[model samples]
Structures are given as structure tokens and as C-alpha cells.
Target: MADDKSKRDFRDRDRVSADEDYEVEYFAAKAGVTPQQVKELIAKHGNQRETLEREAKALRGNG
Candidate 1:
């Protein structure tokens, strides 16, 4: 018999997928920034959620 199980590693949970519009929008809302801003930040910073959050705050003068 073969195993039939699903694996959920969640390895990239801490990173954002800029290619995904929903993820971008979600991060934008969470960070209180616009999607465009989020995209730019992703380009500048390598999709690290924490870094993007900090950058978003700094962009909004909150950090």
C-alpha cells in the first residue's frame, strides 16, 4: 500500500508572495499601506514579512 498523506511545512509563511495579488493586498491592509507600496517594498526588500512590515511602518512615518 502507498501512503496518502498531505504535508504542511509552512516554511514560507513568514515570507510574502509578491506574485500573489491576494497576499499583496492582505499585507497592504495589515501594514496600513497601499498595494503599490507593498509591491515596491517587496522589490526593494526581498519579501521578508517582518522587514516589509517595518518598511511599511517607516513609509507611513509610524516607525
Candidate 2:
């Protein structure tokens, strides 16, 4: 069975910007997902730093 957390669309790729640098594990923790998932999202999306910020905001209930 898959983790219920993994089933959720927690990572917001649209909020990511292209000119920022973010740590993989940090982003994953912020996004409530796995680091590998964060990496995949970064690869599929464009901006990583922006995404990380967005994920952080989401985690903080600010996004």
C-alpha cells in the first residue's frame, strides 16, 4: 500500500521560481513529501527555490 501522504499533491510546482537554489531534503520536509519526490518535482518543474519557499509557506500555513 502506498503512503497516504504520498498520495497528496503537496508540492506546488507553479509557485517555484527559476533563479533560486534549494536543498532537496529541506524542501521535502517542508513539502511533507520525500526528498526523492522533491527532486522529481524539481526535475519536472522549473524553479526549485521558489517551489521550496512555496512548500515552506504551505507547511507554515502561509501559502
lDDT: which candidate is best? 1
Expressed as tens digits, the lDDT of each residue in 1-63 for candidate 1 is 322225546687799888888789999999999999999999999899999988999999953
Clash totals for all models, in order? 0, 2
Residue-level lDDT of model 2, residues 1-63, one tens digit each, is 323434657574445422233545655666676666565565665545665555545545732
TM-score of each: 0.81, 0.42
RMSD for all candidates, in order, please: 6.4, 12.8
Off by over 4 Å in 1: 1-8
Off by more than 4 A, model 2: 1-22, 51-63
Candidate 1 lands at a TM-score of 0.81
Clashing pairs in 2: 16-51, 17-47
Please give the CA lDDT of all the candidate structures: 0.87, 0.54
